[model samples]
Target: MLTLAHALLPRIHHLAVPLLSGCSNDLSSRRAATGPSNFSIFNRRPTAENRSRLQALLSEERYLALDSYQTFGSNKKNKEQEATKHTKDIKLQDGSGTNSCQEQNSCLENQLETYEWQLKILHAVLTASGEQEREQLLKDHSGDICTLIHSISDKVKTEVRTDLNELHEKHLKSISEQYQSEAEELRRIHREETAALNEVFASSEKTLKEEIEGLTSELKLFKELKRRVEESTLKRDLQRNIETHGSPGEFWEQEQESLLFVIEMKRQHLQEQRSKLLQMQSMQNEDFKVRMENYQSLIQQLSREQNELQEALEQQALQKQKLSQEKEELLFKLLQQRTDSCSSFQLPPVLHTHLSPS
Candidate 1:
């Protein structure tokens, strides 16, 4: 039993060495590759200083190896605990199954021990018996011993094979169940995370769309207000121009026509005054001609009376002188009146200059 236990220890150690090394290697690679960026969607990662510190720690071969060893040990401990719990549960669930296998294993061991003891005893008896007796006994029991040994070995082999098949099937079933459960959990977590991300995206998109619409509305309102303000300003400016400079085409035309009418009336009045002055001048000239003819005829009659009456010659002379003086005075007054009328009839050059363009 000691020898068997020792032999199995070596085999167990050999199997564990590669597994431990592989686990250590995998842990070191994972640690080296993992970064802060792997955890977040925003891509925020560890600072360069933190990365440098981690690299510095990893740079020491002993520390790196120690860390990996510690990690692997912790993982192994956790796995061992889980395995122990699972084994306990299985024992609780199916205690009779393990008990039966143990009984069968003990039974097979007892049978093997019995078979070995029998062979040992037979060897001792043969040694103790004479050569002839031993030969005779061997010839009688050799075939039977061979057949019995063969039968026992065949039974043990069949039992062990069946147990191994059952164990393998149980292990396969357990592993498949574990994988299925883990896959389901992973799928559930993925679905929840995807839904959360989609919800966030939808909310953000809605908010942005609303903000854009609001901004667009505000812009349109500003444009409309600006247009209205421009229109109002233009209207105000037009009103001011009308107040200062009068209305455009129609008002200007009316004002121009009125001015022309006033100018024409002024011109007609000036012409009428000139014609009346000319008629008054002609009448004054005719009255002066008649007065001169009457004076000439009176002078001739006074001369005939003087010739006919010498005694009143002196009085006649005086009367003729008085008549000549009165005629001169009347002629001077007519000339002065003609000059005043001519001066009064003359129009200003400014009026003629203003009317010429029209």
Candidate 2:
């Protein structure tokens, strides 16, 4: 950056030195460049009439940079107001709970971008002006012209780099702090949610285990009853066999089938609960992904807006340059016409003197 300043300073001095040392010659060169008529006007300006006209032209000449600066100032003010309003709106939204802090952060980021752009525009406008216009502006605005010039030189030497560094530092710090807070909040929420989920899962598992234990105890009781009944039946059957030679086994087979059906139902209930838990986890992950996508889209939108603004500034500069050139041409034509009219009036005088007999 210092190297850039050093490089520009020589060019600035070159431009300024010519204007300071030989303004008339510079004006003559400019007139000569415009057209033959302007060059004639410049030559004719030594006469009293032409001198007065030249003085009038000099007095009435409006520097293009003056208007450009006024326009820049008005636009800058309006933009600043708009940025302030935007910030206020963000604050209001935040206070009302209508938008999150992230939105406020984004708004601030946009404001910073706008400020940076405005600064660049200001720098361009200042540096783009002709040396004469700059000199006039400085003379009009400052009491100590030399001091002001030196100050400007010093500022040009370091200000651009300093300002850029400050802006970057500010932006980086804000972004870092914002992300840090967000990350901390996310970590806290994650911990809370994880703990809650763990508690819920533990409770569910405990309930399932209690239920399984109860079912196991019930199955054990049924088995014990079946064993006792089988023992009694065996004794009775044996007695019956002893009394009336017979056998019984169909009842025992029916009891075993009923116990198998109860076990299958318990297994099906456990599988259904596991599937529900898996579905809930999947839904949570999808929600997180959607949120991430939204954030990325918002960042892209901000970048696009910044790009558009930069392009607009560049177009405006181009248009301003074209307008300035057109204005200069018009001024030259007007001066040429005035000089022609003055010369025409002098023609009749010379004709009268020639026509008179001496």
Candidate 3:
């Protein structure tokens, strides 16, 4: 559009200058002539052929200007579409370009009107019977024509600047909207990811909780079975001792005390293990796998200790059985010696009763 304005500027200057010069010359010639009023060298009317030629030129110029305006309008439309599609890369268009186009369009129309008026005034001046009418017509239109031409360039520049500023603002607004949309999309995606992570954590937590419960139940069952086995073994040992001694002896009492101590120790160990399990259960912040591993290790340690305790108890029972056998042999020897020494003497009933083996 700017190029178009620049091109039209020179054309307007060339066309206006020659026509204005010829008008001035004709008016001067009319002023100088003293012949009857109208008949003079410069006052001659233009021929029909000249009038036809001028009309054809004016029509062609008007047609060219209209064609250019239409072409510019189409191009502006295409460029606007492209701008909308690729907002980030869009060039700043002059905001007042449309107004400039309209104004220039009006200016061109005014120029054509002035030209037509000038042509009419020229014809009338040549054909006028007197000088007064010619002078009045020139006086009425000359200033207006000059003023329009002089202001055209300034108006075009101002409107172009205005148009550019407007385009720039529009471009900035588009970019802002684009940024806002992207931000919203990012926020939405973040929310979705957060939700997904929460879901996964929840699922894992639930699974871990279930697994812990299952392990706890298994541990309780194992401890119960272990307790029953130990109790049965102790009962069997006690029964064997009872059958051998025919009564509970000091050895049996000592064995029972040792067994009670071991049971107390085992109970204390179980209580400690239970406390550890409770502590582990309370530590929800720790990782599930780590806590699980700790629980497994603790259970294994308890099992190892239980096996050692069982082995110790078996060794103690074996030693007690050997001592009981020696004690029985000594009692039999003492009984035989007493009976020999008192063969003609009567023994005390309490002593004899005590010396008799059960």
- Each model's lDDT comes to 0.48, 0.48, 0.56
Writing each residue's lDDT as its tens digit, candidate 3 over 280-311 gives 66665566556557656755665565566556
Worst 10 residues of 1 by lDDT: 349-358
lDDT of 2 at 312: 58
Candidate 2 has its poorest 10 consecutive residues by lDDT at: 349-358
Encode model 2's per-residue lDDT on 21-104: one tens digit a residue.
Answer: 233344346554764343321122233443344334323322322343455457656766767777678778767644353465
Per-residue lDDT over 1-358 for candidate 1, one digit per residue giving the tens place of the 0 to 100 score? 2233233333323322332233233433443476323321111233355334434432442343345446645765676676776667788887744644346545644544444444443333223335456445444555544443344334444655676556656655665565556556655765685576567656755765686577568767865886697569656866766887886665556656865896697679668856865775576568557755765675566555544454344455465557656755775575455334323212222211111110
TM-score for each of the candidates: 0.31, 0.29, 0.37
Angstrom error of the Cα, residue 284, model 1: value is: 99
- Could you tell me how far off, in angstroms, the CA of residue 107 lies in candidate 3 after the best superposition? 20
Candidate 2 regions with alpha-carbon error over 4 angstroms: 1-152, 155-160, 240-358
- The whole-model C-alpha lDDT of candidate 1 against the native structure comes to 0.48
Candidate 1 segments whose C-alpha is farther than 4 A from its true place: 1-139, 247-358
Give the Å error, residue 82, model 2: 65
The TM-score of candidate 2 is 0.29
